[model samples]
Target: MRQKAIPALETLMSAARTIGNPYLERAKKAGRKIVGVLYDEVPEEIISAAGAVPVLLRGTGSDGTELADPYFRELTCGYTRHTFNEILNGKWDFLDGAVIYNSCDHMRRIYDNWVRRPVSPVYSFIYAPKKGGELARRFYAEQIRDFLHRTEERFCVTLNEERLGAAIRLHNEKRRLQRELYAMQKGRRIALTGTELLLVMMAGKSLPVEDYNALLRKLIASLKSCAETFEPGVRLLYMGAHADEPLFFETLESEGGQIVVDSTGFGEQSCELDVREDADPFEALVSYYFEETPAVPRKFGTAPARAGHLLRLVKDYAVDGVIVTRLTMCDLWAFEQYMLRPVLEKQGIPSLELETDYILQNRGQLATRIQAFVESIRSSRGS
Candidate 1:
């Protein structure tokens, strides 16, 4: 009966695509300005306050990365290369403007290239402070103020605390609803397949939080009466980013593995985290920064801690095997993958490692590997 959930999961992905596409369409129809945020540094509040929608742009599928090879070296992360490819291909032509943050050297160079040859004419570079020292804090504050001034001058929208707070409240409400949905999954009140949850979480980057929350709430309510029995399957815990794609989970399920928990940003990143109204917004931002597991290339204090934390999660969740889906060109995850594999294996845990693009075009290969790995684990258990 696990196979029966595939259609329902596909329906979820279809709904997410519809929701994300309509926002782009509405912006085009109304001629309302829209800006692409390169990474997580573009504050959702800033975009909301500026009267422009913030679309989180990332690389997906092989098609999006065709041109990126010439722009970014093969050694660079595939995500960055694919992002440039998307721009070069005019896939992001609908954007009225874009904000690129200097989060890392590669991303900084991308920002430089973007400003020089923008797909959209109104691109701006925002330098994100790397150090959390007092100087860095002051620098970032001034940068935020300057960015707001430029945004107001260009977009003719003032950034006020009230508007910012409202945006925060909206995001907070969305988080609450997402938490409810996650609770349903945790409690087995509904059996949402892994890929379905990944699609839903990914939609958060493009869709309006309020609308997505409503859809998720409706979905939860619709599935509240689901009384499916959990089959005795190899419980798995996923620890990487590329597993955020539903097809990855579908492949694992097809191989007789069930993902019971995930350590992906999509699964746990923005959920249950709230920006307190009374606290300084910048401080709140800094606090949120501290709370997040560092993405690739910025792994100072986070990697070892995240490794330990994930190990604990694996034990607690009763996961039989760990699947690490390292994204192609993501050096940080590659390093973490190396560190994590031996540690999990040393503990007598079976693990599988797979590298993938954000989109799942090579499902046949992935399925074959997963099936082999699951069979190996099952046979070992029997022996």
Candidate 2:
């Protein structure tokens, strides 16, 4: 059965590759509706259901914060400023419509500015609640429903509960297969590289869920049958803000480290437990927020809880060291690094922190630093 699944999985990945700006190119050529979704909101399924392609706008793949300084103040997070500048520069002019969510204060302000300033083909603000409370849930559900209503009106499409449920099921299956793949990493049976996994995860943002799941199942089966080829390496647990590229992990692998577990959304974002169709769908969304690991809106209690979560991964996977990667100007993860470093280090665990951007242009410098760190661990063990 495992061997049989491989062909299907490859096909699925092929389909996912058609999404994002790459897919937009084809959509434009063919004259299909292209909707750009802001980070982490507007599920890919929703856009698919609307007869439009959803491209996640993660901002420019550039370094050097100076490029964004003129538009946003120095205090603003780099991610926000870069995304805003991308819009100002017409980098995403091809988009037919955009869904922006108030995920953070910075994002909220960006949305406001986009509305006042004339940019993007079409735009809407999808309000997101900041707290976990009954009021917040009600507000968010209403907002999602309103957003759907507006999208339907604008695009001349109908969105019903049945369609939403189907989308939910499809996404759920994709996530299940991804979880299974991560589980294989936990046992070191697959020796899955981080770059490979990141590609798979990003593919999820735009691919048809059913097709993506099919590919993952096939990939997992292929790896299982070829388990004998897998080589043992230093088990690693990764803790970081979103990784810019998979090259960081590739470099680590070159230094004899295999990432056995990761605490970021790349590994666990889709792991939110399944939702029941019988229950109110809105309730399921709220439940998802609570059940998912590394709950967002990082408050005081959540930081220590996240650290404890990392500690468990260390023990469970026999991790040799923890690699915490922070995007240059991401304050949340920066604060997380400051807070969690001592906790992990005090346990007598070795750790390395790397600052990086979305592009791999600086791979030469990064490779040297990674090699040095890994070699130091090897020397310590030898002594």
Candidate 2 regions exceeding 4 Å error are 1-32, 41-45, 60-69, 84-91, 117-122, 225-229, 290-293, 297-300, 360-364, 379-383
Candidate 2 lands at a TM-score of 0.81
Q: What is the lDDT of residue 285 in candidate 2?
A: 48
Per-residue C-alpha lDDT of model 1 across residues 203-296, encoded as one tens digit per residue = 7666655556667677666566555536436767777754434456778778777776677755655564677768766456545543443333
User: For model 2, what is the C-alpha lDDT against the true structure?
Assistant: 0.64
TM-score of predicted structure 1: 0.84
Error of 2 at 306 (Å): 2.1
Count of backbone clashes, every candidate in sequence: 1, 1
